[model samples]
Target: MSVTASQVHGAVQTLTQSSDTLFLLLGAIMVFLMHAGFAFLEVGTVRHKNQVNALVKILADFGISALAYFFIGYWVAYGANFFADAQTLSQGNGYELVKFFFLLTFAAAIPAIVSGGIAERARFYPILVATFFTVGLVYPVFEGMIWNGNFGLQAWFESQFGYGFHDFAGSVVVHGVGGWIALVAVLFLGMRKGRIRAGKHTNFAPSNIPFLALGAWILCVGWFGFNVMSAQTLNGISGLVAMNSLMAMVGGIVAALIAGKNDPGFIHNGPLAGLVAICAGSDLMHPIGSLITGAVAGALFVYLFTYLQNKTKIDDVLGVWPLHGVCGAWGGIAAGIFGQTALGGLGGVSFVVQLLGTLVGIGIAVGGALVVYGIINKVSGLRLSEEDEFNGADLAIHKISATSDD
Candidate 1:
């Protein structure tokens, strides 16, 4: 039988759609596993008494995030609804469905970031409520603005700056938003009971270095999918993004290793800081520019974390604010600088646009968190009672404690 041109086109389209769908499904799965990274990272950083709580909060919050995003957040972000019958929704080889799943993983990351910052003290139910609102309403508003062009902001940027603000993998949209929101929640919760006494900061060592290291490793490995698969289709994929991400990650490790004076926590977290910063410009920069960006992010995380911990009263349990918020913001700005052709980058982003966009995302995050957490504090309360907190969140809240051997 002779194949018509139309038939050939249709077959090619089908294959392309199937490939893209599988690609995104794999990316979603990788990102989903990052939640485990989040859980163990928090578990290791917190006291043993709170280990169970850390794990529980991350998993539960992910559940809440899925419902909120599937039912509400996705529509808000894209103005698309899944109200259609399954047959209709499954069109295009179900690429749209998998797309939602991919984005849902990113949306859920907001709560994962917050869990680390507020671990050991936050009440379980109240934090879950925060996750619902943050994922459903606050995060989607900005996600819509940047990714879907829901607002006129992108249009205005293109009109004036020659390009819209670029965030290849959500440095600002996901990490920045999550980080700043975590900062607000951290401030609201105040210091953990004995974090600061007599104006002296107390050090609470990690309960398990191995677990923390494992979490970092998972995040680092999964981040390839996070950054590269952001292309969303086989046609858009670029090896440069992968190369830049690797360079930035190593850059972060080396910078943190030096800046942190051989601190293992800093070393493990360094790659995360670099990855966060490189997310925005990963598609646009030379590997060298990416390395510098990651290095700057790593050093900035180390210094800001130290300053926030020892010189300030901020009790950010896992330094979420610095790791996500600060590094994310740096990523946004670095994209503008390193994405310029003058700097051996792709040359589309504007520094001013990047700055404005980053600031707006941060503002929205802070504002949304304040409203959600403030109301929860007033109505339902945000933290465990003094006695419950003293007993460790595991036994106090979950009634299951990890014994020393376990």
Candidate 2:
């Protein structure tokens, strides 16, 4: 016999709430593990001397992001300002608190991505300073204004397109910030000493493959949370988001293999690039769209990494631009191409809107990151001395070395 209508309703509610809570919690844990990935990946990408420094920076920056988010970052980025007329902060639990927690993790992760680009050659103290500025001040303000509907891009996204913009998982917000920061750091730090000196190529090999591979894998796993949890509610949509994520990873891997690199480092960029590519439209895309996005991102990442490393002379040690920035741009545009209002209303999965939103986000993130880092560079100095860099940041700044003593 069929259940009564009331009974059916009750069962549905219970199932949805329980599943939502479980998935969100699981996603949070997965996202947290991404920090480990960053630690291993960044450390492995740098020289042996800077291994400890790379790990330390990742850990410390996370700490700083947590603190900053708790204090001001949360309020600025995801506070109850946008839907001011529509909602209010109750006693304890509300969207305000929920959004804060969700966005804080993302804001923190952005700076972590940049840590690798400046590895081996940036001062320890400067790392702390940069993290503070990036997480505490820069990222929060930009993200809050745009997506949170508090101050910046909300009206633009809404008025110009007749539909608000949607990131699904912060392609423009988190990755864009990190990419821009990496750009600034590299420009300020300049090329590694021998990389440019006397025109001799001093290949910087990863110190530990385990660390690098582990980091890359962890990042891929954690990305499920990074993309899915952004929904703030889990339903069938969670499955779609997760599916897109997987497809994108496959695409990235294929692209990496096609790029044909002797080094694993080049190949590793594929997964990251794919993740970044699908971020904007994960919830909106068909399975095929996700697959294509990931594939393109993976291939683009390898090519971009090679070009930046050999041709452009910008030493993005962790390949932030290709993985986050370039793929982020792709994600944004893909959102425009694939996004549809039928998929997720008001958010207007429209491709045109997505393209405009992507450009806007890029312009602001790139320009703002450049300015903030430039100012920091002018003040305390962003790069370690040539001697310090050659010796290793861990030894120069932290007084510890990964290498064994004789």
Candidate 3:
């Protein structure tokens, strides 16, 4: 018996769809593991008394984020819903389901980012409610404008600038948005107790360097999947994306090492700064361009994190604003610079459009976070009582510490 042309065609189509699904599923899993990285990073950064709260918040936020995204967020971003029966929903080999899984991980990151900034003092239930609103509505609105071309924003950019805003893998959409929102929440929550005395700031050393380093490592390893898998199809995979990501990582590390004067925390977070900056242009820039972008991001993170914490007296525990907000914004704008043909890049982006889009993202993120967090703060109060703060969030909120002996 010979294989018929129609059978061969059908088999090929099935194989292609199956392969794509598998690829996205793996990508989603890797991105999902980054949440563990987020948790451990916060655990290591905050005081030991607050360690368990960090862990719990990340996990809980993810659960709430999943619910919010499933019922509301996904629809806002992509105009798709899961209200259909299983068979109808499972069309496209259930690629849409896995796609939701992947994107939900990204959506959940907003609260994970805020968790770091507000850690050790935030009220658990209020923050969870804020997370629900952010994931369900705020994030997806901006996400739709950029990724889904909602509201003619992209069209306006293209019409005005001759090229539309181009964020290949969501520098502005995910990291930038998360970072800015975190900043707003941090501002609203105010400084932790005793962090400022006599108009001077105090340093709260990380509880565990090993844990922080471990989290950074996990995030670094998983970022490859995060960037590469944004393609969402096997045929779309690019070695350039992988190489750019590598170069950016090292660039950030080296720059952070120099800028931070060999501080262990900065050294560990350097690669993350680079990865965050390179995320937008990973597919378009030359490796050298990526390195430069990463280096800039590393220096920016070190400088801004220091200034924000000490001089400005903002108590952003994990420096999420510098790492994600600033660096991610840089990634969005850098996509236009390094992605220019003049700079050995693919050259389909416009700097004006990038700037405009980045500004829009920042505005929406800050505004939305302020509104959501402000309402929650007013209604339920966002912070722990001073007694609870001194006692630590782990014991106060969860009735347990990270270690049983504690």
Candidate 4:
């Protein structure tokens, strides 16, 4: 049978829709795998007694964020149709459904970061409360305004600042927000046992290098979907994003090797740093730019983790700030330099405006997290009882012992 003009047009439309759906699905799968990465990473970093607690937190955050995103979180972030003037969202029903899954993944990052902060000793209920607020309110409200085409903060920045800060994916929206929350939670939860002494620090080797390796690998791989899908258009952009991501990870690995003085633990985290760095402009920058960004991010992780560990006595059970906060900041700034329209319009942001917007994002992220964590601490109390902390949260709180008797 001869193909009519109408048939050709219908075929094209079907192909286009199918392509969009495929990309969305790919993004969802990659994001989900990052949870497994977190599980191994967190469990490996903490003591054996607390391993189960950390792992449980990772699982809980992933599950809770999924449900929360499906319910109120997705609507808050992308459901502007809940309000009028959400024209772009209204045009496609699929966009609405995809938005929920996307935001769920994004919102999960904050709770994941916070998990490291409260690890080893916190009561699970307090963490549950914090997760509820972060997914349901903090992340969705701000990021929704950014991507949903609303004439709110992002638009205001673009109008007044001559260039809005462009995080091609979610360096600022996801990783930055997560890091800030982790920082605040760390403050409220206080130091873990043996972390603070008179004037010196002790080395706490990861319980399992294999676990750390696995988590870092998962995060690095998933990042391709996380960063690339943010562009959300069918074309060569996904390839570029993936390429940038890979190069950045390579650069990070090299940087970590050099900075760590050949330590395996430091080298292991390099991939995560690279992934986080590229997250800001995976679709907007060339491979060379990713190389530079990734190296810097990897170096920053080394410095931040070491300094914070010894100086502040902040026992980041999984080094969340180093991987998420520092690298996430690098990714956002890199977008300003490499996001030229020649690339993907990410570098088109003016330096000054991008700086301002970045600061505003940082402020919102850090300040909101501080306030939220403080309140949670006040209401539910952030850490476990002193005796409980010494005994380990896994057994103390959950009754899941680390010993063979279990």
Candidate 5:
């Protein structure tokens, strides 16, 4: 029997959709691994007693994020839902399902980012509650505005600035939002016990530098997926994003090394700062521009992290506000600068538009965080008791230490 042209065309179309779905699935899986990176990073940074809590919070936040996003967040952002039957959902090789999974990884990252800031003393259930509302409501609203174009926000920007906002991969959408929200939570929670003695900052050295290094390495590796897979489809994928990511990572590492004066923690985090800054413009900027962006972001992390810890005595435990909040914002705005033709970039981004988009994200994040964390603080309270705090979250929360001999 001869296959007709229609049959052949249908086969090819199915094959293409299947390939795209697989591509997205792999991307989702890779991003899911970044949660591990987040976990390890926190584990390495927090005191030994709090290490288990750090590990648990990352995993728990991801689980909570998955549920919230699946049931509420996705629909809130995109006006879509999983109320459809599996047969209907599986259409297009289940691309939509895989897309949800991919984006869920990003949504979950918000709580993970916060985990670092509030670690050591936050009540676990309260943080989970915050995660539920955050992923379910706050994050999705802005996410929809930027990615799904739910509101006329992007259109409004274009009307005024000659271009819509240009966050190609959520420097502002994910990292910046997560960072700013983390800041509010950190402020509300206040410094960890013993974090400040007198008016000066007290040093609580990282529990494990090797573990910290490992976490940084994992994040660095997984970020490629975080950046590259952001294209969402095979046809949209670009080598440029990957190259830019690499250059930016390298630039951050080098800059942090110099600015941090060979501090190991700073050295590891340098690459992350660079990657964060380059995400918004990776597709459009020259590699050199990405390198500069990354370098600046890396230096920013070193300076801000130090200043906050020593000068202000704001105990952002892992400096999420600096690493994610500020660097992420810088990256979003930098996209506008580096993505212009005059600066060896592709020239569709408007600086003013990018600036406004970033500000909006930050504003929403601050408001949401204050509301969520504030209410949670007022209602159930957000901190462990002083006894629990002194005992370490391992025994207080998890009933065991990470390295328990028994």
Candidate 6:
């Protein structure tokens, strides 16, 4: 039997759809692996006694976040839900399912980012509650506004300025929101025990450098999927995104190495700071521009992490505010700058629009985090007791340590 043109066309389309679905599925798996990075990063940063709590929290938060996003967050963001029959749900080669899985990884990251800031002292269940509210409501609201164009905010930006706010990926939306929210929770939770005494600061050393390095490496590798896969379809993918991500990562590392004075923690976190900054404009900016953006983000993380921890007395354990929050914001604004035609970029971004969108993201994250965490704090309490603090969160909450001695 001979194949007709119609049959050939149909087969080609099916092949394309299957390929796209597979690509996104791989991306989802890669992003999902970043949670392990989040877990081990927290594990290596906190004291040995609290290591188990850090590990447990990331996994637990991912579980709760999946449910929260499935039931409410996905709907709030895109007005889509899994309420349809299985047949309908599986349409488009189950593209929607894999898409949800991919985006759910991003949604779960909000709580993962917060977990780092509030680690070693936070109550597991209460933080999980906050994560549900944040993933289900707070994050999706802004996500819908920006990515889905739900609220006409992007339209307003385009009308008021030139082009609308452009976050190809989610520098401001994911990292920035998570960071600002984590900052608020950190402030509300107050200093960790013995971190501050007589208005001075005490340093806390990381428990495991190897684990920290491994976590950073995992995140660094996974971030390519995070940034590039945001295109969501094969035709939309670009080598520009890949190159820009690479430039930004090295830029962050180089700057962090210099600014951090060769500190292992800062060096490991440098690539992350750069990648966070580059996510917004990865497709638009030239590699050199991305390098500058990443470099700035790296320096910003180093300086702000130090200032916030020491001078300001904010005990943001993993420096999420600097790495994700501030650097993410910088990434947002940098997109407008480095993405301009004059700056060797693809253009079509307005600096003012970028700033406004970034500010909106910051405001919503801070406000929503305060309300959610604040209520949780007032009602059920957010922190472990001082006794728990002394005994370590692992022993206090989980009844075990990372290692057992007979």
Tens digit per residue, CA lDDT, model 1, 31-139: 9999999998888889999999999899999999999999999999999999999999999999999999999999999999999999889999989999999999999
- The residue-by-residue lDDT of candidate 2 on 164-240, one tens digit each, is 66777877777866787678777878787767656744566777887888889889888888887877666445688
Model 1 lowest lDDT segment of ten: 397-406
TM-score of 4: 0.91
How does model 4 fare in lDDT? 0.77
Worst 10 residues of 3 by lDDT: 397-406
Cα miss at 374, model 1 (Å)?
1.0
lDDT of each: 0.94, 0.76, 0.94, 0.77, 0.92, 0.95
Question: How many residue-pair clashes does candidate 1 contain?
Answer: 0
TM-score of 5: 0.98
TM-score of 6: 0.99
Per-model TM values vs. the true structure: 0.98, 0.87, 0.99, 0.91, 0.98, 0.99
Off by over 4 Å in 4: 1-3, 80-95, 340-347, 402-406
Please, what are the lDDT tens digits per residue for candidate 3 over residues 287-403? Answer: 999999999999999999999888985889999999999999999999999999999999999988888899999999999998999999989899999999999998899998888
Tens-place lDDT digits, model 6, residues 1-406: 9999999999999999998999999999999999999999999999999999999999999999999999999999999999889999998899999999999999999999999999889888999999999999999999999999989998888778868888888999999999999999998888898988787898799999999999999999999999999999999999999999999999999999999999999999999999999999999999999999999999999999989888986899999999999999999999999999999999889898999999999999999988999999999999999999999999999999999796
User: After aligning candidate 6 to the native by TM-score, how far in Å is the CA of 201 from where it should be?
Assistant: 0.7
Please give the range of 10 consecutive residues that has the lowest summed lDDT in model 5. Answer: 194-203
Candidate 2 vs 3: which has more lDDT: 3
Better of 3 and 4 by lDDT: 3
Cα RMSD, each candidate:
1.0, 4.6, 0.9, 3.4, 1.0, 0.9
Clash pairs detected, candidate 6? none
